[model samples]
Target: MADATTIVPLNPDEEKFLRALGTVMALLPRVVDADMLEELPISSTEYTVLVHLSEVPHHQMRMSELANVCGLSLSGMTRVVNRLESQSLVTRQKCPEDGRAWLALLTNPGWKMLEQAWPTNLASVRRHIFSRLEGCDVAAAAEVLQRIAAP
Candidate 1:
């Protein structure tokens, strides 16, 4: 890694772009979280977890896998799972293939919750993002942002 002192400074346009990106990054989550919390019983993070599980084969995933994809620590994920469990939205079960491992399974109610929240989430995205961008603008933004977000 380069030392901070050796790092090159950004040009004015680059600095402005970086600032805009930073602001969006910081605020977008809050906006979505607020929208979800206002209209739904779940937070954005919980919706994210549900979405990932919904995409999986059995609406289930290992706790470690969920934690990784959600960018939460394992213990942090456990707490989130616990909250969902208490709400009857999810269930924790021992992994049949590995007794020591745990899986978070989305319940019927969890799927119902996702179904209920889908329209609000879509509308919020359209309002906050898609409606402001032309088709080509969205395509280009997706390409660049995907590259930046890749692990």
Candidate 2:
């Protein structure tokens, strides 16, 4: 039997794929940040927080839920949301079901900004990711990404 110290190695192609994936992922944030700065007032991370909130039903979600969706910690999300709320982009409402909990609500201004910014955001995404790949390859890439991100 093989010892725990022995492990199978990734083949050359597999290693290359991983290297490319890491590089692309590293650069992806810059792409988003540049585009967001040029087209919107918010940073890419903040835009993503807003985007995640926008996807929820009624354009509202709890702070914990938003943090999870945005891959952020609760405290980090709290800061972002507090900044956003101060900017009039979002509002915090006490959850009726749980007095201690709060829901982040997208304000009318936020909704309007999101609507105006969506097309530019989509364009940047398509330019950086989808446009470079073919149709079938794009679908395969999405599946591969999903598989990689899944637990």
Q: For residues 31-82, write the lDDT of model 2, one tens digit per residue.
A: 8789978978876777787788788898889899899878889999999898
Where does candidate 2 stray beyond 4 Å? 1-4
User: Which lDDT tens digits does candidate 1 get at residues 1-151?
Assistant: 9999999999999999999999988888888888998998898888889999999999899999999999899999998899889889999999999999999999999999999999888888788878878556777798999898898
RMSD, candidate 2, Å: 2.4
Count of backbone collisions within predicted model 2:
0
Compared with the true structure, all predictions reach lDDT values of 0.91, 0.86
Model 1 vs. true fold: TM: 0.90
**For residue 61, what is the lDDT in candidate 2?**
92
**What TM-score, computed on C-alpha atoms, does each candidate reach?**
0.90, 0.87
